[model samples]
Target: MIIDCHNHVLATALPPGHDRFVREMRAPGHRRAGRLPAYRPATDEDWVGLEGDLDPIDPGTLVDDHVSAGVDRATVLAVAPSTYTAYGERGTIDLGRVTDVDGPLEVAKSNDYIASLTRRHPELIGMSAVNPKFRGVEWARDELTRAVGELGLQGLKLYPMYDHYAPADRDLAFPIYERAVELGIGVMVHMGTSSAKDTVLDYGRPGALDEVARHFPDLPLLVCHAGFPWVDECLAMVARHDNTYLDISMFATKSTQRQLYEFLLRARQLGCPLSRICWGTDYPGGGKPAVLLPKLTLVNDVADPGAPISRLDVANMVGGNWARFAGLTDWSEQETLEQLEAWEPRWRDS
Candidate 1:
């Protein structure tokens, strides 16, 4: 089955007195706590980008689009900027303010809406967001438990750099990690570039994850964006650690295509297993399937040529691999070919 492992959904509820939609885009870091940036919400541009005359956020629309694209499933995370916003020099600006809807009930309501969506579409798996800095370890653990055990979420999504915490800093995130491991919940951490204005570049590197990996060797960890600027370091980390894996999110842009190709070739030469790498669209931010498909095709074309990776591989990268990593097994693989027989004809025609 094919899966888009990294996509986000917006909360349906708007804060009281707040516009149902956001018009003015706030600067990267402006507010902390609940004053986080809400999803731009669906726009005509987003629909056009998806190659659909209508918005794709609806379950039926999304499912139909995925099936047409040869994807069988997708995993979604809630879009909460505060979860990733960091401290800026001007003051403490955070995406958390976006979640600031008067109280925790609002956050729960928003999360429940996404969870309800997952229930409506079995193909869509859910991931709940948690900001350890905002809620201490105990509260974070309780909320995560509710999200997973009660809400049936597959895992927890975290933005350490944006939350002003270092992935490797045990004092900051170890409690949360410990709770996740105890609860058997997978943790996907944002690695690489900070989306925040006051981000510290060094804190987001793959190496920063080493301490966390060492501390919780059994915890399933996914480094999104393949740690971008440090792709090699990410590959190396995956090569050395059994529990570490990388996701190809927001890396299919034109500017990074050649670098990605080179990195894949070199990593293969270095004996990195293809299974360690997974696909992700980064959706809303990376553009939709229509724009991302060719880029994904480009990477597969240069890496495997003839056989390349199958659409199933794409699915695996998007969701399946993460499922296995998270300890879920409700997926099936497609037929394998001894060799890629369709490459020459496909490449020539394309």
Candidate 2:
């Protein structure tokens, strides 16, 4: 079964008037302009405001897209509402002016909603999002417990850069990490380019993750975005730490994809296992599966060089690796193989 370990689905409950602020913040010439080229504003009727006759952002459509992509399962993450907030140019929140102490609570609610979707569709898994700074240690601990113990979330998503903090700043984040370790929930952190004004490039580097990994050697941690711009460092860190893994999200560009294949080859040459790497389309940010196909083809072509990548390898990226990493093995590889075989003729026909 194929599983996308990292993909985001935006919640429809974005506060009224928030979308305009997010669009303006991302607009060209804006102080918080994101690194990527600006996106056209999403219209009200558009599916998640994306440009394309794509599947809707709801669960049924998401499942359909996965099946179409030959993916049997996917780990869906919630993009934080604060990821859209304009906190000056530095992405820092002015805590004093904020009236909402429910930022973390709202995030938990979104996670629960996604978890419910996953429960309905056994193929989908939910990854919870948390802002350590806003949620703080205690609330973060409780939320992590609830997400795992109650909601059955498979993992946790963090955007330290969006929270105006560095991943290595344990002074403020250690407690949350401690709780995560205690709870045994895997943590997936954003570790590449910034889409917010307050994102500090330095904070997103893979080197900053070393201390955290060292501190929680038992916890499985994934650096999302393949640690772009610092792919080499990320590969090095993954090689050095047994608990670390890399998720290839937002790595659809041909040039970047080639670089990633080279890095994977280098890691293999150094005796690192390919199982340590997983695939993530970053969804919304990555556009549709059709737009991402070329890049996926490149990775597949290079990984095998001659024959196509085995269904197992594809399943590894789609969701198997994540399931293995998360210690959940309810899904059977044999069943996955059966599904793949059932679909193989269709894929060849296409």
Clashes of each: 22, 5
Q: Give all candidates' CA lDDT scores.
A: 0.61, 0.63
What is the alpha-carbon RMSD of candidate 2 to the true structure?
A: 6.7
Candidate 2 structure quality by residue, lDDT tens digits, 184-283:
7788888977544545778889878989899889989888887887777887888888998888777544246566556666766655566777777776
Give the per-residue lDDT of model 1 (tens digit) for 1-350.
55677876543223321111221112222222224334543343333332321122455555666555545677777542232232211111112333233433344344455577788788888887765665566676677778788888888878776567777766658887888898887788888874434456677898888878888899988888888878778888877777888887876542355566676666676565667677777765455665554455545656544645555554455455766876778655442111113332443353
Candidate 2: 10-residue stretch with minimal lDDT = 88-97
Give the Cα error of residue 72 in candidate 2, in Å.
1.3
Clashes of 2: 5
Q: After superposition, how far is residue 294 of candidate 1 from its true place, in Å?
A: 4.7
Candidate 2's C-alpha lDDT?
0.63
